[model samples]
Target: NLEYQGAFLYGEITANYDVRNHLFEDIKLRYDDIYKGHTLELGNYKYMDDGAREWDISFKKDKGYIITGSKNYVIKENVPLGSRVELLYLGIIIDIQNATNGVVEFKNDEIKEDRNYQLKIYTPDGKILIKDISTTSNYNQQNKGEVEYDINIREDHESKRNKIDSKVYYGLTDHLTLGMGYLREPELINDEYEYLDKGRLEAVYSNYIYSLPYTFRVGGDKVFNEFEYKVNEKNTKDDYSYDFLGQIDIKKVRLRLEHESKGEFYEDKYKTKFYVRYTPIKALDLEYEREEATKRDGIYGIDYKEKINKYSIEYSKAYKDLLLTGEYEYHTEDKGKYSFNTYYTGLRTATLKLENTWKNDGKDYEVAFSIFSNGNRLFDYNLEARYTEQEKDKFTFRFSTNYNNWFDYEMFVDKKGNQEHKFGIDHITDLRNPTAKIKNMDSSPLKVITFVDKNDNDIYDEGEELIKNVEVQIGEQKINTNENGEAMFYGVPNYVTYDLEPKIKKPNFLLGNNKVQVQGKNTATIVAHIPVKPMLTLTGFINVEDILELNSIDKMRLYEELLVTVKDTNGKVIDRAIPDEQGIFEISGLLPKKYLIEVVYMGIDHQIDGINDEIVKLTYVDVRHVS
Candidate 1:
């Protein structure tokens, strides 16, 4: 493409080829010179052996370099005896200067980002020595929106048939979504079929009304079935369906309502449901819901008219971090064997559910069980369990299972980014052949790394140690580092912001950035770094002359005690120190900053007409006296 501005051009070229055997490679090159500084990018993707894959991307601009492939660096420092200096990466301490005496030596294997750092020197007893310093930058992975498609395959041995379902969804905007779905066969497992037996195009719009949320959805669907003996055009059918939903959420109350109408192959049905929830206090919540459904069945077989009404009530309470909920439901249905007639058969059913949720560390866990029975038959029951852990950096991990032999496991790599890779194993209804599944995931999974910045440089040094037991969170999933200081999250979604934060914070450590925007299923990695802060001890004196006494011979000790105030550069008073018996006062553990010190004096009226103050720059320990 050519642009009129300076007659510049911009274009991209992509190529794919098989290197050898089962090995394949893809290359993309982009060029643009519309601005003062021309730009070029070379991206290479390779499918490695044993199903491994990797990507290499390079970008170039103008005369100076923006990013190079990789580099190594080192750091060396002299330290006092009994000083504890540690290098931290991703908030985990990787190296510490444990020597009681001698020069302190530290270095990193790489250069990462550019920023300021707080370097802490601590005493052997864990008291702080010197704390503040400046650092640089390290590498950060950029996340972008991604699109994904999923296909499900199932086979039934009893029926000798197979099923395949494909679905895709993409967001046109934050509130508008579009989707498509297709289901093949009458549970047909064979590949001999050429046509998709059923397909649908769908769209949904969601918006908010102050504290209330609402959504509208509409979709068009079509299905075709051919008799074994003959195929006819009339066998195909198409229809439209829609749904409306609304909800209101407040601190102590919530309400939700939904209505949906559908057109099926044999009949049309409509259903409506509404819920009301109230929280009378912090620890307790009450809720009620009602559902109504009317369906006309038997269009092709034994016909019947059915109407169902259901009502449920629930109570929930919080016991510290644990939450428990119990619910009871009553359902009644009327059915006319042939049509809406005078003689109707009525059925009543009841169900009960109990759920509990709690948290350990920064992760959330939940368990729910339900019992349902119609009349006096054997009761049907199911139990569910879910566990989730999220880090301060937005890395997340989730696990769920049900009594029906169904289970789901998911790991999110970068919760702070717009895109994420998701790895999952889902819905194993048949134990004989568990369906291992992957969604919103490419051939490669997303990576989240934690390391220590030993040199106080923003760059990531090769030898810089990786820290273990550190929690990394992507969105709502959390995982802790193993012995090697690494945690991997899978099944990340695209086109959304996944903020990452550490669940646990170490003392004297400060975080850099807590989140990143990740793009879809494409492999992405985010590194969260926390640097230690430097400490200082500030000593000062407050001297009062008591000038009104004039002839007082002991001027030096005229007023042995006085009050002094310390304010930061922003004029915010952070600390106050008063001299002890020796007229000397000291404050420790203070970070480097400019401070305003003042000597306060008062008369019998407790009012000050004039006072002297001093401003000093403090990085390390220093003595400042005021009168």
Candidate 2:
């Protein structure tokens, strides 16, 4: 039987034999991170149960196969690095601890350190490789507080040359390190001017200017640059170059700068770099970079958005259903010459975006389209619609309107027998479960047009009329603002309010300042403004003799949302209300409680002192709602 706890596995066993068994295996599966790193699997699994035994099992897992005589594993120092062990615990046969079989081994069997005095070499895979002095080496411990030497040699033959060069550093104190090196035999042309030798000395400190999210890092790389160029086989001019980079993170944004100078004396060329970024707000980001005429240059980009909120206009672009963005980018050579061609004064890059939606229940529809232009002069557009319903006698509505620079197309459908005759354009047909078919027009990358019902007789009634701008508002409460500057509410008990206000200012045509009391859902339409007129007025508020507005009512009806709060003294909220479609709300399942009634109507709210449902409150009556 075996048991598991935390990150360890425990097991037990029992067997019988009294000196009658010969060569009986006594193995206790012992897994103690047997091996870790490159030469081993995540951890090694050894089958410690060498021969047949009373009970045994092996698993290549967290509890890698190990068998020991005791419950705990042997200490790393006690276990010989290359030897395998198998043991017995209590009365159980554990596992197998296979001997090392696939690698180089020495007579003493202690992981051979570098075979020779070599520090780096190459494997058959042709990849340059490096190995550090093992922790077991006295040389490593002697140089403990020093930068370990890292050497590199050719993948061809490492033992032949001292291409094995590395910088070794030794620490003398907490802030200072004394270091020196002669790693490479710098080649000399004609032996006139050469690198000869190189060395370094440095100091470091902490606990400087402090900030929670920002940090400052300062360091320098000093490379002795020396070399002479041979012209016509004779020593001529010399070449030297040095460089350094400073990077810091200030408040989450990154700041980086690099400075480099090449060539000796008067011919040296120096280049300086600067970059900064700030994200002051979550939704907006700003950046800037400049490398001057010495090479790099560019005024980066800043972007933001404001599309989903009410009373807002979108400043965006689109291409074939994909939305694009805008930004300013300057250039000075890097991303390839002509990356920012100075030859063109009018050509600019542009991105596009298109909106898409799916339709299945299929009756409701809405459309919005726009085209933004830059010097790139690219084109893009997309339209989407969706509708779903669960009822049959559905008088669903769908209408089209044009708001862009595209060709126009018209459509109409007639049903006969079991087939439908769709007019004007091509229709791709699709059908789904429980008997439903959808016929749609083909989409294109070119021009597009929208068709609006002309005579208001959605039947595609022929020869009736074809008015281009015939005030196409769809609904039964159809209307046209008369010469008297207004259209009367018809079919609809109350005049309709347009969600968007007008933009023009002259010859004002507006929603009537009147309220109609009727119960039930009703659709109303009214003449917004005359052709070429600018009227921006809304009319939907009740009032009381120039002093206050209509705040409370008894048996009247309303269509908008209301926040009804029932409360008592000490500002304690007792209950609240949310009305439904018919402007009728009966908050039931309520236990008897004291409450002050506050009614939210139109844009104003009204409350009154406690009044029992047993008494009828008069219309438009004002009560202290409580003191």
In terms of lDDT, which candidate is strongest? Answer: 1
Score every model by TM-score.
0.29, 0.22
Off by over 4 Å in 2: 1-149, 154-165, 168-207, 212-227, 232-247, 262-268, 279-288, 292-331, 334-627
lDDT of 1 by residue, 138-249 (tens): 1111112223344454443334355567665566776777778788644322324434477777766666777565555666666665423133222244333566656556
| Residue 296, candidate 2: alpha-carbon lDDT | 19
lDDT of candidates 1 onward, in order = 0.44, 0.28
Candidate 2 structure quality by residue, lDDT tens digits, 1-627: 111111113211111122333322232323323332101111122213343222223322221112235112221111211122222111111111212221121121111211111122221112222322222212111122544342332211212222223444444543344444333433444644233333333232222235522222223333355444555331223333455544455675656565665443323256666666555643233555666323212234322211111110112222332322222233333221110000111223221212222222223322222122211101211121222233212121222222221222323222222322222321222111213122111100110111222222223233332222212132333333333333333222122233322122223322222121222121112222222211221111222224434434532333244545555434566556655543444433222223345555444343422222222121112222221
Candidate 1: regions farther than 4 A off: 1-148, 155-162, 186-196, 224-257, 275-286, 297-305, 320-325, 333-627
On a 0 to 100 scale, what is the lDDT of residue 103 in model 1? 30
Q: Count the backbone clashes (under 3 Å) in each candidate.
A: 75, 28
What does the lDDT come to for candidate 2? 0.28
Could you list the CA RMSD of all candidates, in the order they appear? 25.3, 35.6
